[model samples]
Target: MTAILSMLPPDWREGTFLGRLDLGEGPVPVLLAGGTVHDMSGAAPTVADLVDLGAFDPAQGSVLGSAEDVLARAALLSPVDLQCIKAAGVTFAVSALERVIEERARGDADQAQAVRGGLEERIGGSIRSVVPGSAEAAALKAALIEDGMWSQYLEVAIGPDAEIFTKSPVLSTVGSGAVIGVRSDSDWNNPEPEIVILSDRHGKAVGAALGNDVNLRDFEGRSALLLGKAKDNNASCSIGPFVRLFDAGYTMAEIENAKVLLRIEGPEGFLLEGESRMAEISRPPLDLLRQAFSEHQYPDGIVLFLGTLFAPTQDRDTQGRGFTHKVGDVVTISSERLGTLVNTVATSRDAPAWETGISALYRNLAARGLIGGRA
Candidate 1:
């Protein structure tokens, strides 16, 4: 309830949103409609089941209270439960360049600036303008290869295939107002603010939420194979506030033009701000979704993180060393439609351990007598 105004969508009453709320007992699916919060656990115990049900009529459940009242008292949770957390990387030209910088620098923060300047000068324009997988992209690829500047990151950036990977475990993501972690050993790390799509089992986007894909540039820069370590960590993934379901007033088109804003306020008076315009994304969100769902199945649904365009290069403390997170830094990611997701940074070693899994979720649901079937 602290700074509650900044947490929910500005148009909370107009936009139909879905989220999980824990009012002491356990996490349950909740719906915000016409400014009222409805307990959806009676209709569907989990948000994933609610998605499978394909309907969010408030009339189907008992009213908890007004949105303002409920949100103040209940603990907000990540919008999706039981869904695989997946993310698309290098979907934006700037992000692609940043990845290249990380790669060329070999995760060494001191070498980033030098590598970035030359990399951008050589290929930034083409990467920015050429459509991915297009003939122009292919030509650019051939040209880069000829010049010996081709990279694995470039292959995913302009090549036919996109970079999609499992971001974290199903129940591991922390919600808004929680502590997001960065590995203590990582010398270069930052948050990747993104628009996460909540999709059904068939890969159809149902709603969207704000997400922070906490990234460790140094680890992945050391080796592409280190991506798993660079990304997944205790309290690494932060999502929500709420999932704004697509409706007449808000749809995919709104998301396509959403300008995501990021602000980092550090304890030592360090402040950094940046924005990611979805309009500049090299690949379409739906296209990324298709690549993610190509041959895999998410029976319980999936939350796909559309890659970020804002890659922080601003100096945090050192003269030439790029941005990196510090403990106690408050990171905020927000957009007009998705409201705000705010979290304070902490080292992964110090953050709370993830103890709950799918089994615990089912047991809790059964204990409440809410797990049998959709009502």
Candidate 2:
């Protein structure tokens, strides 16, 4: 395989150690040390020799094997060993031949051809108008590019009905690299635990932005006997922060202000008032969100939910209580600087037809002042 090497300065490999391969262009070489990659500049004897020694079967690139092997080799080498090869300076290289070969064998054109023929035969020309340029059409194009297989680039968070935590908020790190912890109770006390992932970005939270603590009350108060398996009985869950940070370019300060808002709607389509007799909170919506993220060490993002807002003791069987979310309930959340993000997650329950019934419900609700307009 043909290799391309990017050279560095004479002292680039001096006292620096290799961790893993960092793909970039710079004087600080990306070192493959201790099964990870890091950027550093120092003097080293022979950069080429070090690279060869760190090489291993790419197919064995699992977390335990190739990763461990890479780390082990770097740990065995001393500073003196690196200094002897300083004449070669430091250089980062990758096999161009291997990359090209992999691309041609798995490129987009070949897959699209295969699917286009089959789709045309089965569905006639119903799908021909759905070209791959538009945003909606891109999903099919992506699927075709991946050879009809489902591909996901983010980790999902899961928990029982009781746990309010989602996979998104917690930050998990190891050695240097990190990912967002999407699973519930991933690390109970760590507050912000490392999710153990390999990526190019640093200093970002992963998974969902925020989760509700109310989901965990039942489990926290229950007896040991009632808690079956610890994994099965947990409550609530979320995921994000990991891919979103890379995707959205979130900074630590920006993440701090992310928050959630809860709105309770009564039968008359008005917000329910808080009663003084109940345990009440008058904290501004943003304040509640800021405090939650700070207290839980949530790095960034918002996980807002607008569901039934009645207190637990309130009569849930009343007319308003029976009203689940409809198409018209307007939910709006905003930050001082971040503006607002709004969406409706409701659908008709008794709609027999797909298009007409659903559209009619939303139109009717809008007329009743349940949707549209400023919140």
Candidate 3:
């Protein structure tokens, strides 16, 4: 087992710290403190686990044993129930590279260049001030100096197949053990959500966690008109190590200072690495919360992958050197505040089949002004 390190609240460590672990007896909730595990077997057997117990307060129980002893015996479940994992659509972009990549993949050179030109022009590059026809015709500049690029991205919905296409956050699930299982090869996916904001029954932001909005680049590259295929799938998303509940004592400065580091490694060596600040996120966590539930509802709890600065993708210069994960690959998104989320790559064996016909319908609808953005 690879080691996962995160700051367990020092205060909670004395007595109140709690988590659920499977000790081969079955999945049991445990009270953790001082490197010890307090037995919660059959204890939560009725109203059951921590979430139902509310606040994770441990009922009086005998000490289970050393933390290592118990952890060694059990598998860790995601800290949150994860009824559904939702992504705020297009919340951030390193540049316009997302669409640019997809457009180029379609073998449409002019449109691809147009996408880049439009973005570069918005940031006021040396590119003719008028729209340049060729990559060489423009200076191609801008350093994320302006927030306007991605600040107003409209949230969209994600569906596993084309049938549920809509401009709203999509929901995907992870399998047991919090694995982001997928049928595609490793390099095909990317993760988002520099900050994972958690909300309660009323959709109010309540806690924070580390999350991976796993994306299948193959699906994404096929068409920008639809993100559902690339966005949602069984075990395509995962969150946790633990969640950091929001306290009144926490401040905006602390939130703004949060840093997200995306790291990936294969059987040989490091592959991709990038860092960004929470403040760079177009929608603040709180603001994203408001946008997320504006139309939908989550009675249990909701997870919002706020956004990210840039994704670690294949180099734009070399088409073949693209980004994708393979078997045995490990990807980790770490944050001091939210902790660390780690996933080892493995292609899902029994995943289901999905259709892409709906994307074409969505593109048609978008062009007719029936929906929000275009394809």
Candidate 4:
């Protein structure tokens, strides 16, 4: 049985049923409903399209909820709706209005148009926020990646928020290699807490093990806003080759036998920190992210991020409003995943004292005539 609905052009709204036939095995009867078969190989025509052709009887299947009820439960409703549609069969009826929405999003239209239209209608208004691609935007994005790091850095009068400005000559410190560490503070505040290098890949820890949140406090004494910090360096974030998850596919079960170690040599090539177990961390490594992007629409051979960690540190003598970052104490983060992320002790690096890198980018863009008109 097929549920026919008129959707956008190019058969974007039509759904088809697929059946499997065995030539030599004497009449194999495996019929797949709510799914479309493009050719003899049962391949889907569009990668993003769903195969919901109405195969099963909802009456026969377990009746846990209404059409609206189920829809509410499956909030995002892309792949999940596909599963529900296939399972419900003839007994389940979906409002044509509901199916139109799904079709529009997954249709053959351009991605930008689809996303913009959907957000406007679904979220009750158009998006009016305009931000410059300046340093401020960059800083805020970096701060949001974890929880407390940004706030703490801002509080201590360190990082991009610091008032000092001095450029440091690019120095060759270390080679491109992997390093692992843990969140040393029970809470966020300390910058670059001692990192204990782990083995290549071995060992395990629970309750927010690598990829956990390291919380921090920004404007600690003055405001209620929260911030966070972690070793967001490209090398600091490490992960095992594999991950174990529950059947529902939302929670992490356990990290099976994963260990990490590292050795860091100082200015004279003397060991600064060496041979320590990486028990837990606030974020996952770049390699895992690379694998995930590969499975999706990411372009091939894109290096995700550069190694750099910025945390907040306090300065007692220089507590004032509208502070800026300094050069020597600032940590410049450059990543393939994220663009140049620069943070310094409040007094480092002499640039306009903007609140964020996004502002800086916007300034650069405006100067380049990218914004189309004067702001």
Candidate 5:
């Protein structure tokens, strides 16, 4: 458990911590370091109290004050609001597989070819998207057809409106929080350790931190037409503890090899657990984000998820009906230096049941893929 300090400059035992906190009014940016906390409300106020505050300047700095001086009983809602988020596209092969399985469950016979084309058009080659594949489209085609895991992903073709390899970063609004409130009983939710970077006005990644890029599996199956339904939801996106600033001297490649781990638990036991590196990711984080920023604007600020690697192929423990996340499943996504984002599973409002015959069938197939157990 190396402290996050190692990721910052040696002179400062801890880099200036920036995030949002609830100080009665609502959520506002705040800083924590050396046993003290500073509020940034005077600079950028809450989303509800937003005014013509110009632009959110992370460098405008914070107002000096102690948490006790303000209110000792205040909740720590310190992860600052990034005006927009560019939801990551398929940056991992495993994720691609997950989408394919989802379409297959939806009864797409050409799912494999569709997924393969997405790999070529949206993700393949630096000229197109950031999930770099060979310049020779044939190479990617060969790999998809020859690789067993990939072959399985292509069993059903991707729908015309799939979100796999779109060059631009997709807009998303889920924010930082401790609870994930899905909308369905069959929400196949999984947490992945994602490194989120705050973009400068020019779209360069100014800093990074640990993130939980929550995914709801049910939506990916319902339709490939749009990802907003599957990926974006209330309290689904979260990042925090603090942001480690990235100065010009430092390069995004420095964190490219960082280790990320995912862990999920129900009353029964661990459902998903594994470790992977940013190196395993096909899309370059900065490039993926830069392209996304090229089209979108965030006067306040924006957070970009790099994408996920490993996740359970199927559902795990539950009370009775085999919906993925139960009422109290705990999920922890972590980075040794950046720390962890732990959240509890809960649902928002009463929702219709989606774990009917088809969902169960897909879950069983995914579970069978892990027959020998977790790798």
Candidate 6:
């Protein structure tokens, strides 16, 4: 328990955080401020409601306990509720390259190394230097297409538009300390550690959190149509410890310059570490946010994952197989200002089924008198 709590930011006590906490009754919105975790149920029914309201005062909330004591007695949820979960892909040069490798190899781990070497030699430097949608990017694209090296991944990577997709349904995201799932049948897969933005009903960026976007390389590699199977699954999306609201101390600058770190400790004594510097992203974070909100509405709110730059390529067991998660592997994602998110890896087929959904949440809230009635 101590170790899990230690995953939080070193300076957590000083920051303002919003999250969901289940103290055996049901999940309730919690506010951590002035070194105490306060029950914000009096302020709002759900975190989504509190965020949409946009003016919650911690002093008005009832004191639960110190942050440590409260977290110790309760299970922390995904820090988001009733919000649409969205994600951007191929926002980094390395991720774009990996997607191309996955496509060329057709999900075959054995063929990935061969394709990786050729792809890197062909357009690696060019891709890194050119800005997405720029004339230089267009010239490079034309050259790659002429050379027969163009890919759908590259088109999205360097194209005028970004690739934004629904990551998971509302109330489906598991919190830190919960088991994160990958497809059982997927032989090639990895965890994507990213910094997620919390947007209000008005599509305004209000806060940020850490997330593990567990992915199945093999599934998506076989066909783009398998994206649903490869991406969304039971226990697949893990976000939290908590969402740190943007304030005078922790602002957009913290998120813009944040260095998201990943560490995986396998059951068999395999250790791997990597990082994704926000500085290396091909598209600005807000640009992706605008693209996601373009011609759409998320009245409840949204949790948007700014694509990761850390795509593990280290060999886990087999020499050329690259990195693939094993059951019991502990994945930790942390940033200086946003704190840490830790979760264990499990096969989607074996992990606990996603039972509590929007209906269940509404019923629980209504029964607890947290809300008027179920929608």
Regions more than 4 Å wrong, model 2? 1-250, 257-259, 262-267, 272-327, 348-375
In candidate 5, where is summed lDDT lowest over 10 consecutive residues? 155-164
Candidate 1: residue 247 lDDT (0-100): 92
lDDT (Cα, tens digit) per residue for candidate 5, span 185-280: 444656666887766555756667777766666666667554565555555555665665554433476568888887777867657677767886
Name the candidate, 1 or 4, with the larger TM-score value.
1
lDDT of each model, Cα atoms only?
0.91, 0.24, 0.51, 0.21, 0.52, 0.89
Off by over 4 Å in 5: 1-13, 43-72, 107-133, 142-177, 247-251, 314-323, 350-375
| Total clashing pairs for each candidate | 0, 53, 11, 72, 16, 0
Best model per lDDT: 1
TM per candidate comes to 0.98, 0.21, 0.67, 0.19, 0.67, 0.98
Ranking by lDDT: 1, 6, 5, 3, 2, 4
Model 2 gets an lDDT of 0.24
- lDDT, model 2, position 13: 23
Alpha-carbon error at 341 in model 4, in Å? 10
- Model 6 global lDDT (CA atoms, 0 to 1): 0.89
Please identify model 3 stretches exceeding 4 Å from their true place.
4-18, 29-54, 59-66, 93-97, 100-118, 121-179, 185-188, 248-253, 314-321, 350-375
Cα lDDT of candidate 1 equals 0.91
The predicted structure with the larger TM-score, 3 or 6, is: 6
- Candidate 4's residue-wise lDDT over 1-375, tens digit each? 001111001221121212212233111112121222112112221111111212222222223233233222221100110010000000001111111222333321222234334433532111112121335545544653453222222222212221111101111011111122222322222222211111111111101111111111221222222111222211222221111111232122222112222222223322322111212221233222332233334111111221112222222123321111222232222211111112222211232222323344345335544344453
Q: Candidate 5: how many backbone clashes?
A: 16
How far does residue 52 in candidate 2 sit from its true spot (Å)?
A: 26
